[model samples]
Target: MRKEKRSSKVKDALGSLTQDLIDAGLGSPFTEKELNYYGINIPEIKNISPKKIKVIREKAQFSQSVFARLLNVSTASIKQWEQGTRNPNGATKVLLDLLDRYPHILDYRINKSKRKNYI
Candidate 1:
């Protein structure tokens, strides 16, 4: 069966209602795939260019090592991402997208007493 494309307003309303159901301790009746069947599709993650990655990091005022630590990735991975040698996938891409949308998302300070040394 072909799913009809839904307007963004309809999708947003349905998505919010679905979240409200979950928040009320009643789990969603439909899985993401099932929701897509009705055209309540999840937003796609967009690809970030290496330059954009660098810009995001700089805007966040984090050095490569610090950014890598924040992302739980090796320093090499951040270097590669900035150099266009590799593309971040899966969860990392989602995180980068979030950072792009909300530049101050990672602005919270970690308590020094509770922070682990990553060296």
Candidate 2:
């Protein structure tokens, strides 16, 4: 199958599984055993490639150091991420997803920082 088709299938499966879980009274159960038993690991962040990392940073007009600062990670970590040696996880992954989805937020952040310099 093509990459895009496979991804869409996986997304549809996940959506169906989620709905099934909800229908089965698993939603908001908040217990480890229930989650484990249902085979539901819900930290479903997208995995991005090294090239994508560079593209996202460049689209936001940020250098590696600046992008690292924005993401609150080390410059070395950014380098590793962009080199495909590392993958972002947890809160960093969440932030990167947000930035990728709404790049204008970076402009807003930059403007906010400039305003701070006047104070």
Candidate 3:
């Protein structure tokens, strides 16, 4: 629907989505049109090519190592995010999903209700 709308709810949904995807494979079993619905292209992330994760790093001009460090993860981790060999699980996936929709705002805070944030 809208950025605000997705932002407000997707975080909650993504954990389940991530689990479903882990169980099924890349959002396939989840039946979320947001991930993949053939005819209807969901507006925002439709253009962000799957592991357009590489694009995210490039657009931000971040070397994989640097971006990985920014995420408090290893360079290999960023490489995995780029290559799509391994899915970013737990909190990382949430961050990446947020990044996919709003690339520039990756570093912003999302779990505002939680205290003491990091990375």
- Which is the leading candidate under lDDT? 1
Worst 10 residues of 2 by lDDT: 110-119
Instruction: Give the distance in Å from residue 8's predicted Cα in candidate 3 to where it truly belongs.
Output: 23
Q: Write the per-residue lDDT of candidate 1 for residues 30-90, one digit (tens) a residue.
A: 9888677545566787778999999999888889998888888999999999999999999
Please report, in order, the local distance difference test score of every candidate based on alpha carbons.
0.82, 0.77, 0.62
Candidate 3: tens digits of C-alpha lDDT, residues 36-68? 422222334222333577876777666787678
Write the number of the candidate with greater TM-score, choosing between 1 and 3. Answer: 1
* Candidate 1 residue-pair clash tally: 0
Runs in model 3 lying further than 4 Å from the true structure: 1-50, 106-119
Clashes of each: 0, 0, 0
lDDT of 2: 0.77
TM-score of 1: 0.67
Q: How close to the true structure is residue 45 of candidate 2, measured as C-alpha lDDT?
A: 82
Model 2: C-alpha RMSD to truth?
A: 10.5
Give me the runs in candidate 2 sitting further than 4 Å from their true place. Answer: 1-43, 111-119
